[model samples]
Target: MLKSEFAKTFAMLATGLSCVLMAQNTLADAPEHRIINLQAEATREVANDEMQATLYTELNEKDAATLANKINSIVNQAMNTAKSYPKVEIKTGGQNTYPVYNDKQQLVNWRGRAEVILNSQDFKQTSELIAKLQESMQLGNINFEVSAEQRNKVESELYIEASKAFQQRAKLLLAPWGASNYELVNLQLNANANRPMPIYAARDASFKADSIESQNIEAGNSEITVIANGSIQLK
Candidate 1:
């Protein structure tokens, strides 16, 4: 009877040990790890506040120096016109003079070209000035932009929002898995602005107007995008 009782007690202990070992092995094999990927976009419309346009003009002559001088004169006139508007800023650009080659590859004429960029914070005034000047000079291209200051502010706010979004997702995910919290492993971020394309036109056309038509300009909102990709340990 004593030996039988001792054997029964040993059997019970062995069974309990086996159960504990199995539970530990299950946990070790199915360790909880998670990865959450999320994206956030923020956009707001500000005024089409700024204007960017280029002036392209050319002069032709037999003498290279004469052609250059004529081109310079036209450039100066354009500058003077830009000065009339306090909001407009005219920046001198590259000037190029190349010899024209005929079928025989002989230099036939000297051509001079110059470009200038005009930037204005006031869209209405800039557009009006561009139309007026188009009659006297070549209209190269026009574009609209959001100020650097505005873009930076938007990006900063969006990044904060993205971080919060990531944390929220992690919390929700862990809660469903019967986990109390998650340990963040990594994080990364990025952002951009959408602007209008430049308008390009030929130099020969006159900007002079019996009636001037203003373009419907919209400075539409800049977009701030943030991508959150990382791993978390659930516990």
Candidate 2:
């Protein structure tokens, strides 16, 4: 073979090898880092299947002992009356005695306030008990609440929803940067319940007769909001 031809052959082989090396390096050196961030929120409405109410009864007694007995009878009767509702849980509550002051700052009489809280899973039953308690022990204000079981279930669903939203956001953010593949490095979930307004007027027994009517009670929707945050990496 001629020396020139041999040299030309070697040059051609070197050029092909260089092209292969360059292509391999380009693939390996593809984008190594990218910015991917996402945010999401979720909400759910739950019906309040449970109910709570604070019932107060005030009595005026000439003697402490007699007043105690009288107040006890009123509370006991009210509690027992509440038991008539198969779904209601009746429990004894407050007992207090204080001196009543007159306009001249003189002791007019002894005032005793007795009370109990009625809790039930049945909304209608709870409402009826509150109304009837007023006729007897003079029902006080009624505050509403949700059961523990229901709240936990709602919160779990909310968390799942929030996680889905975060994932969607991360995908959207990464799409523009040419990165759609990612794994959740970390995830956090938070949730809470808000208390309902207190019923102060229910404590007023000035018109027990008028209060006999079932209090117009509406168990408003409880909001469960879930927030999830996590870091994602895309290539």
Q: Could you list the CA RMSD of all candidates, in the order they appear?
A: 6.9, 9.7
Q: Which residue pairs show collisions in model 2? A: 134-139, 140-202, 141-202
Which tens-of-lDDT digit does each residue in 82-148 have in candidate 2? 7689898877776899888889998777889987887888877776776677676665666666688
lDDT of 1 by residue, 1-235 (tens): 9999999999999999999999999999995665555444444555555678887887789999889888888888888888878888888888899999899999899998898888888877777777766765777877777777766776788778777877887888877878888788777766655665665666544344433464665555444465555667778
Candidate 2, poorest ten consecutive residues by summed lDDT = 202-211
lDDT of 2 at 74: 84
Q: So what's the TM-score on candidate 1?
A: 0.75
Worst 10-residue lDDT window for candidate 1 reads: 203-212
lDDT of 2: 0.76
Candidates' C-alpha lDDT:
0.74, 0.76
Best by TM-score: 1
